[model samples]
Target: MIYYETLSINDAGTTNNYITIRGAIDIGHNGKVIIDGQNTRSNCIVIEQGCGSLVRDWIYVKNLYLRRAAAEAFYIHCNVNNVVIDSLDIRENGLEGIKIIGNDDYYLTENGICAENIEIKNCTIISKSNNLYHEDNCVYVQMAAGLNIHHNYIHQRNKQIGVPPGQHEHVDPLQTHVIRDVKIWNNVFIIDSSVLGHGMILGIQSRPGRRDTVIIYNNYIYAGGHLNPGGNPYINGFVLRWYGYVNSVYPPTYVINNTVVTSNGGENTILQEYAGKFYNNIICQLGTNGQNPANYGGTPLETFASSWNMDKTYVDSVRSNLMWRQWTNDMSFGGNRWVGSGGSPTGIINGGWNVWTNSNWGGTGINADPLFVNNVRERYGYVIASNSPARNAGEDLQAFIESKGLPWADIEGKPRNNTPDIGAFEYENQIPVEFTSFSATYYSDKVTLEWMTATEINNHGFKIQRKLGDSEWKEIGFVEGRGTITEQTEYSYIDDIISIQTSVLAYRLMQIDLDGSFEYSDVVEVEILPAKFDLSQNYPNPFNPSTTIRFSLPKETRLKINIYNMLGELIETIAEGTYEAGYHKVTFDALSLPSGVYIYRFESDSFVQVKKMILLR
Candidate 1:
C-alpha cells in the first residue's frame, strides 16, 4: 500500500506531519508529488485514524502538488471509507484547500464515524488566503455519504485591501454540511468579488430526518465583482447557496444545466430554500467593467410555502405538482436562456412561474442575445455561436432523474448530442468535421478507423461506412479533405476482411462539405473474435430481396440461425438467442421468401455451419 519513488516534499518549515496516512494506506505518487509547505505547515496530507485502532478502507490519493499550506492541504478524518481524491494541484493554502470530516455527532441513526464513498475529482483548487481568524474554504465537506464533487478548478484570489471585514471571512468555494448522495457536477467556480460570500454552499447545516439528494449539473460560475478603475465601494455576493432544514423533508433539489456568470457586484445567481427544479440555465449579469451593462437582472431565490396545506398537499403530491400556493416559492422554471444588464427577460428574480419571461408569469423566457463565442472584457467564453440561440434550446433532464441518470457530458466533456445544447457548452453544430477524435480498433483480421480534427470548414473528405447486424450501410473507404484547416488533422482507415466478416462492426463518418453538404459521425463499434467457428458468404449473392449474413464467435453461446427453402422447409429464423463473442451480422428479409436457392444454418453447442445463397427475384 505504498509507491513513493520520492517526488520531493521539501518541508521547509515543517512543524511535523507532512504525511500521516493510516487506515489502509495506499499512497501513490507517479511523478510531481511536491509538498512544499514552506509557509509553516499544519497539514500536508493526513488521512487519520490508525495506530492501535485502524479504520480507513481503500484510500487512493492521486497526482498531487500541495503547495504553501500553513493550514489544511488535504485532510480527511473520522474513520474514512473508500476515499479517492484525484488529479490534485491544490495551491497557496494558508487555510482550507480540501478538508473532509465526519462524525460531528453522526446521524442516519448514528453509528458514529461517517465518510463513505467520497470522490473529489480532477482538482485544481487555488486558494490564496492569509487567514484572519479561520474558515477560508476552497473545499470543505462535513459528515458525508457518497459525495462526489466533479471536475473541479475552483479559484478564490483577490481579497486584499485592509482585509478585516469580519476578521476576513471568505467562505465557500465549495462547502457542504450534512451530506448525502450529493453530486456537484462539471465545476469551474472562480468567485472573487473580494469574497463577501457564496460561490457554492450546500445544506449549510440542518439534517432533520436527514434527506439530502442534490444534483447540480454542468456548472461554470464566475462571480468576480468590483472592476473599479477608481470608481467607488463595491460588494456583490451569492452565486450559489442552498441552506437547508426548515422542517426537513427536502429532496427535490436539482438545479440543472448551469452556466451562471456574474460581476456587477453580484446579488443572486442562485439561492434556494427548498423545492427546486430550474432548467437549462444561462444566468448572466455582467455590468460594471465586467463588460456590457448588466445588473438588476439579479434575482434567483426560491423559498416556498404559500399554503395548499396538508404540508402543501403532500409536498404537492410528491413533487412535480410543485406546490407553493399557500404563501409562495414553489419553483419550476423552464428551458431558460437569460441575458444580462438588467433589461429584464425575466431570467428569474422570483417572478415565480417562468416559461421564458414573467409577464406576470407565462414563460418561455427568451431575452435573446446568447450569441457568445467569447464574452470579452477580462476574457470569458461560454461558446454558443453559429446562429446561437443556445443552439438546440434544450429540454430533457433525462426525464427528471427518478433514478441515476443525466450528466453524460457538457462542461467540456462534450458528448450530449440528442438536442441538448442549452448552456454549459454543447454546441458543435454545423459539422464539417470538427471531430477532435473518433475511434474504432480491432486488429489481426483488420479493423481500424481513426479520426482527428481540431478545425475544418467547408471541408470535403471522409466517407467510411460499415454496418453488419441490422445491416444496410456499405461504403467502405475514402479519406481526403483538408479543404480548410487550422492545424491538427489526422485520419486513418482499414477494414480488411474483418476476421472473415462479422462479430460486430459499425462505423460512420460521411462528413463531406465543399458545398455539397453532408453530416453523420458518431457511431463506432468494434468487436472481433474469429480464428475458428465461421460462416460467411451472403451478400448481394446473385439476387436481392435483402441480404447480409456474416458470423463468427469463439465464446458465449446459445445459437440458431436458420433459413431454408429450395425445399428444405424451415424458411426463416435468421437469428435466435444468446450471442456475444465477436463478429456477427444478420439481415435476411427476402421480402417473404419465394424465388430461392437459400439454405443458411449455423447452430452451436460445439459448432455447425452451412451456407448457400441465390435469392434471385
Candidate 2:
C-alpha cells in the first residue's frame, strides 16, 4: 500500500490530528513520494509505534514548509527501518524540520531499540525566523545504526535568538550527526563561524561509541572566516565532544576526499575526538581573527597535498603532510588552468602523489574555477557545457556502483565507455582533437620537425619548443597551416643547426591554426652525445626532508632505482619504468623513515649510477 500525506489537504468537517501510516508506504508507481507542506499544517505526520513489518519501505518528501514545532517538525521514530528521504525542502520551520530517531519506543521501555538502515539525501534543511534555538537546524538524528547522508545543502544564518541581548547566545553552532555505521558523503555544511565563537561541532553525551565505523567522504565544508596576518583562520575545524559520563569505545572512522574551505577566520584542529583516517582531503584556512592555530595529528596520511598557499607561520609547525611541493604563499597548483589567475584562492600545487596529468579524477589537482552553473548559490551539481574542465571528472563511488542493483556499470546514469570523463557528467559527442602522425630527423646543421594532419576545420597549428634548463620554457617556433579539409595537409619546421655540443636537443610540435587554435605535441628529443645514463645529484641538495632527482635516457630502456638504508636492504623502489630519451625528474620523500644518509642507485639499459643523500632531522 502507498501512503501520501500533504499537511494542507483536509475536509472542513474532518479534524485530522496525527496521521498514522501503517504497512508499506511506498511513494508513487515510480517509487517516489512527494510531500508539500504549503497547503498543510503542523509540519509532519508522526509514525505511531509498531510500524516495522519487514516490508518494502521508502519515504520521498519534498516541497516541505515546516510552520511550527518546538523540535523536529518531521519526526519518524518507532520500529521504522530502511527509510530513504529525497528532494526534502523543510525550510523556515520553528525548530528542526526533520528528525529520524531510529529506535523502537516499546523496545526502549522493555529490552532495547535498534536503529537500522536509513538514508537522507538531496534535502535542504534550514530555519525561518531569527530565534536561535527556535530556528536552529533542519534535520537531527540520534541512535542510528547505519545511515547514508549525501548531497544535502545545509545553511544557517547567524541571527541572534533566545532571551536577553547577548546572554544565552548560541556561541557554538550545531550540526548533523551520525551515531553508528553512518556515511556522510558529498554534503555541503555552511556554518557562519566567526572570531567570536566556534563553528560546527559533532558528537553528544550519547556519542556513537568508539566502536562505530563512520565514513565521511567527498563533502564540502564552507565555514565563514578570514585569513589572519599569518594565514591561519581564527576558527576550529571540527569539534567532537562526548557528553555522557560513560563514553562508548568507538572504532576508527574514515574521512577522505573532502574539501574544507574557511572564509572569515583561521581554522583550528580537525576533529576533537579520535578514531579516523583522513586522506586526500583539501583543507584551506585563510584570513585572521587573532586565534591560535592548530594542526592535524594521527596515523593519518596526507597524500597528494602539502600545505600549499598556507602561511609558513602555521605550516612550519605542521608541514608533515605529503605535499605536492613545499608550502607556498598561495595554492597555485601548476599545470591547472587557475595557476596564476587571481581571486578565490582555488589553485593546485605540483608535488606529492596527488598530482596527475589526466583529469581521471586524479590529481595534478588544480584549484580551477569549476565554472559552476549557479556559483553564488553553490549548486555545484551542474557543470556547464562541453569546455568545462570538471566534465566527467567525478570519482566513481565504488560502493554506489555495487549497491545499484543494476546490471549496467554506468550508475549515476552515465554512459559506459572505456574511459569515462572525470567528474559528474559525461559527454557523448565532444569534439575530438587528434595529433594523427608525426616524424622527426636531425641533420648536420639543424633538426627538422614535421607532421601531417589528415582532417581539420577550425584547425589550430602546432607550438614548437625546446627545453634545456630549470622550469624555463623557451618557445623556439610555431607552425601555422590549415589541417586537411578532405585531403591531407603537411607542415614542417627546422631549428637551424647549432653546435651539437650539448648532450641533447629536444624538439616538439606546437600545432596552431588560422583562428588562434593550437595543441602541444609530445616532447621528443634527439641525443647527440649518448652519455652513460646516470642519476644526477638530487636538487635542493641540502634538503630537510624531500628533493627531486633528474635523470636522462640515451635510448628506449627499462630503468630501476631503489633507496636503501645503511644496511642496504632495499628501503623502497623510488623509480622503475621504461623511459624514453629525455631528462625527467622524480621526487623522494624521507618523512616516515629515520634521518640519515641514504643510498640510492639507478640502472637503465646498460648504464648504472649510484648516489647518496643526507636527510636532516
Candidate 3:
C-alpha cells in the first residue's frame, strides 16, 4: 500500500476479501506513481507463502510504475485465486517482472491446493533483466492453471547495464511450467534474440492423464533477431518440450489466429507434442521467399528455411495457417507440399487455402504474402490489407470452438465473420465504409482519427463523436464520406482537443447512411502525455512552391524554420515564432524560388533537423 493512492479492502461476506491497489496520482493528472526498488528489495509487492495464502483471493493491482527490483517486481507465492495485475509499467527488474509460484506435481497444485483464476492485462514490462543475468522475461510462472494473460506489451530487452559483456541466457516473454487451461491473447511480445536460448521453453513436466487445454490466440510476436550476423544467436522462436510420456488424455490445445514473425532462418514453432488444433495463424520466417533452391523452380532470397515442427505421435489438426514465402520445414504430423498447378491431389485444394496432409486431417495450409496493411515486418503491423488474399480464406472453426464454448475474437477485439481471415486480425469487412482499420493518434493539443474503407454502401458521411473522461458523447464534427464506392478509401479528422482540457479523450465515428441509418465504430481512447519536439518531412516534396511542414513542441518554445540552399546558403525563413505545445503545421510557398534542391531545417533550443525538399519553380 506504500505506493498506492488508495487501497480498498472490502469483506466479501463469507469468502470475504477484495484487495485493490492503484496509482496515487490523480486520474487524468500529469504523473505516474512509480515505485523505485533501487535494486534493494526482493520484490516490490509480494503475497508470500503463508501470510494470506489460505485466504488471499480477489486481489487487484493496477496503474503503477515499478522498476529496479532486486528480484521480481510483483511476486505471488503459494497460490492466490482471482488475482489481477493490470496496467503496471515494469522495467529494470532484476528477474521477472511478474512472478507467480505454483507447483504441478502429479497434476496437483502444491499440496492439492489449487488457485482458481489469475489474470494479467494491460501491463507494459520491458527489460525485466538488465542483461546481468542470462535469464529474464516479462512474466514467469513456475506452474499455474486458469491463467489469463492478454492486452499486454512485453519488450524483452537484452541490455545489461553496469555488467561485463557476456552471454545472456534464455530471453523470452514468458516461461511457464505444466501449463494447462491457460489463455494468452491480444498481447504483443517484442523478443530480441540477443541471448543463447532465444525462445520460450515450457517444461511440460509430468503428464497428468486429464484433458486440459492451453489456448493461445491473436498474439503478435515481433523478433529483434538477425542483427548479429557472425553468430547463430537467432536460434529458435517457440520450443515446447514435454518431458513425461505422451498421453492422449490431454485433449486438444488451441493455438489460433496468431501472427508470429520469427528471426530470419530460424525455427518458428517447435512443439514436443502438438496435440492441438493450429488454425488461422500467419507464422513467417523473416525475409523468406519460399524458393527451395535445391527443389524445383526455386529462387533463393535468403538462406531461410524451417517454420513449424511437431511430433507424429501427438499429431495436431492444423488448418488455414499462412506460411509467408518460407521455403520448407518438417512441419511434421504430415507431409509438406507446395502451391502449384499440376495433378488433382498436388494442385489447389479447399479453395487453395490448404494442402491437406491426410484424408482425415485437411490442412497444412497455404503460402502467400497475406497482403498485410503495413506490408513490412514491423511491430503491430500485422493487420491484413483490405484486399489481402488472407481475407475469408480460413477454414470455419465455429463448430469446433463453439463446442468448446470459447470466445472467438480477433487481435483487435473484433468479432470474426463467417468466413474468417488466416491471421490474428480479421478484416473489418462490415457494411457502411467496410472499414478495414480505424485508429486515433494523440498530439499534445489535438487528436487525429483516421480510418480506411474497403468499400462503402449508402454511406452519407461520418459524424465524429467525442467524450471526455466518462462523460456523455457529443458530436464534435462531421466529415463528408464517399457515398458508395468499391475501391479503398482513407479518411481523417482532427479534433481541436486542447481548447477544453481533460485528462482523457475518446472518439468514435458514426457512419451515417444516406437512408438515415447509422452505425458506430469502435471507441478509441487517448491520454495526454508529455510531448517531445518532432519535425516531419514536407508533403509533396517535389512541389510547385507549396507544401505543408509539420512540427511539434513540448512547450511554448521559439522555433526557426529556415530554407537553405544545397551549398549551405540561406534561402527563406518560412516560419519563425513561439508556438504552443501541440500539433502545428506551416505552409511553405516557394513562389519565387528557383527549381533546385533545398534544405529545410527546424532549429530550436536543443533540437535541430534538416531535410531536403525539391522546389520546381
Top model by lDDT, which number?
Answer: 3
Each prediction's Cα lDDT score? 0.61, 0.48, 0.64
Which lDDT value does model 1 have at 200? 76
Q: What is the TM-score of each candidate against the true structure?
A: 0.31, 0.42, 0.59
lDDT (tens digit, per residue) of candidate 2 on 375-449: 222323222334544444444445533353222122123343433333333434422235566776766547777
Ranking by lDDT: 3, 1, 2
lDDT of 3 by residue, 1-617 (tens): 33532122332212365577778655565577777777887777776544242556778788888888888888876556688888899898888888887643434432354444788998998874344555777788765667788888887766333333365466677777665567787887776654344344454533256666667778876654433333333434454554343442454567788777654443434333444566788866553234433333222222112123332322234557876644554322222322222222432123222334554333456666666545333445566666777788887776765565555777666777678888777766456567889988887577889999998754679999999767899999999877545678999998886555444678899997654557999988876543677788888889996998888766678889998989999878988888766567789888887899988999998689988889886
lDDT accuracy of residue 404 in candidate 1: 57
Candidate with better lDDT, 1 vs 2: 1
**TM match of model 1 to true structure:** 0.31
